[model samples]
Target: MSQGGTSIPDEEWERFLREAEAGSAGAPQEPSARARMVTRRLREQPGPPEGWRTYRPARRRRGKGWYVLGLAAAVALLVVALVPGLLVGWFGGGDGADAPRAAGETQRPDGPPAQEAAGRLPTPDRPFSGSPAAGWADGTAGIHLPAARATGWMSRSEVEQALDRTRDFLAASSLDRAVLRGERPSGAMALIDPHQSDVHEFIEKAFRAPDRENDPLLLFSRFRPSDVRPAGDVVRTRGRISFREGERDAVEVSTDVTYVYPVVRAEAGSEEVVRTVVRREVVLSWNDPAKDRVEPGTFSLVSYKVDATNGGCDNTYTGYFTPVFGAERAATGAGDGAVVDPYDRSTPIGERMREAGDAGGGTATRS
Candidate 1:
């Protein structure tokens, strides 16, 4: 909310509005001097995370000082806008009463204070600042690997190699821009052991012709490019990865990485950034050719589970991620365990595999 450590008062926000309105006639939409100062301060700060470095949402562009005003709105914990309505379609109205709840946010009242107040629009420079993902790592950085140790079946060096490959597979499946924009997840699928043709071909066929039962989302996240685009290039992430010895001289690695994607409707002049979260859980079996008759240096996909929060329930038929926009959906009865908080990183996806991360707890409050 504070831009480069400076706080913005509510009344001062109103003053910007008045000044902008008065200057509207025969005036330019250029940023004010104060906004320019904020821009300089931001440039002095660190750059955004590096994961998929070349992804730009086809036609989106930014104006000067929007990041300053956007961060100001966020830090204030009030609705966004320095010059209210001057930057149209960016955030909820100034007053707390005008705050709009995001379409499929699932945090309970007991959750974080920022989430308690709804409609916190992200700035291009700091997309995760107003959400639970604020504290999460950007892109592949969140997928941390454990120290390699001998685990009966695999040697220490081999275990390390396996871990490295697993991380690559994860990066390809979740953070790859090509995979996200509805392309075949070849980068990820290629890691699958070719001998395990059943699982490999199943994924290939699913992508070729997808449906409810054969969803590629089972292994990767894909959204229709025509419907929505990532708000900023960054994708916030947090979760755990674990490994254990498996049957048939294989090592089983289980990973639970939750991805928070800030997105907006794919239309010109649209700027309200909403988030869609997807939690992907996968079990990878790294088979040893010496004993299992498997291909060398590859893993077989054992199983996978994917759950999406804020991805529209109605959009499931298309087998693409189409998150709800504008308004909330009516409550529903069908769900797993509890309402799965896509933001809750504390929940474990698999049985205790040596305490991968966060303390265990209840999942999100489902509708």
Candidate 2:
């Protein structure tokens, strides 16, 4: 019939009413979506993706015709007596706030509450459910490599090798289950320049009998085997790796990455969970070992620092992280200093590093 100068075909009108009544919706993807960058990137960006408008067809849009059709549909609807179910579906007349919730959903906000209130419980299945790390890439996938370019002193291949070695070092030190569970970080240690005997010896000594002065946790993320264990196999990570030419024809590679470890009490049937954020900043130097006895692909550890937040302030010099949970934090404060956000990656690693339970490991706090 002709209404609002736009004809509403009998078949199209009927189909529209039926679809509205049924409340049609497409099926949701299964297994849930993986988070790309758990940080600000996850938020809705300001505009459409690059070249979005350029690729669109240049066809003219049918503007007010859609509005006229809507008006005609409304007139037709007013004339026809509507059923209760159709009315309810058409205008959302169901329970406003009294509807039963889904099996696992709650009425609270998206993420965990601020530290002022009681800590939130992370779902057992998705340990990162209420955490920012939920959107972050899983494991080493988060550590992406930039296009390898030759520096003044280093060849393209050399720079590429440096990036790989640095990435491997990060994966071995932070994400390895054996190392996290208090085993030796031999893989990570092996990546160090073998010719740097002092550095190698220091790591060996730290592992054998770490004290307040010689702690290995500065470079490796570890948890006390008897105290805490990972909630799942995944460890969310995000960061950047870059390289530049330093003095004396040495290629300097710098890595700044944050690792989020979801851990739970080691006790059987413990449901409580806590996350420990470790931000490590490592500087490695590679020089032409034409005459020296350094390993071909090895890097000399120029310097390394770490910031371990959301952990116990009273870490025993036992060479393992003592993360704080809700119960424990209630009895003993998470820390005395300012509250630290475990997910903040904006700040540099040096500014974040603190002397939290310094194991005689000299003041990591930089001026």
Residue 63 of model 1: what lDDT? Answer: 10
Model 1, 87-188: lDDT tens per residue?
A: 111121121111222222222123422443455556554556456676555555556566778864778877777876787777777777766777776667
Q: What C-alpha lDDT does candidate 2 achieve relative to the native structure?
A: 0.51
**Model 1 bad stretches (over 4 Å):** 1-119, 123-125, 328-340, 349-367
Which residue pairs collide in model 1, if any? Answer: 1-74, 1-75, 339-366
Residue pairs clashing in model 2 are 212-359, 212-360
Q: How many residue pairs clash in each candidate?
A: 3, 2
Assess every candidate by TM-score.
0.61, 0.62
* Alpha carbon deviation, residue 212, candidate 2 (Å): 1.6
Best by the TM-score measure:
2
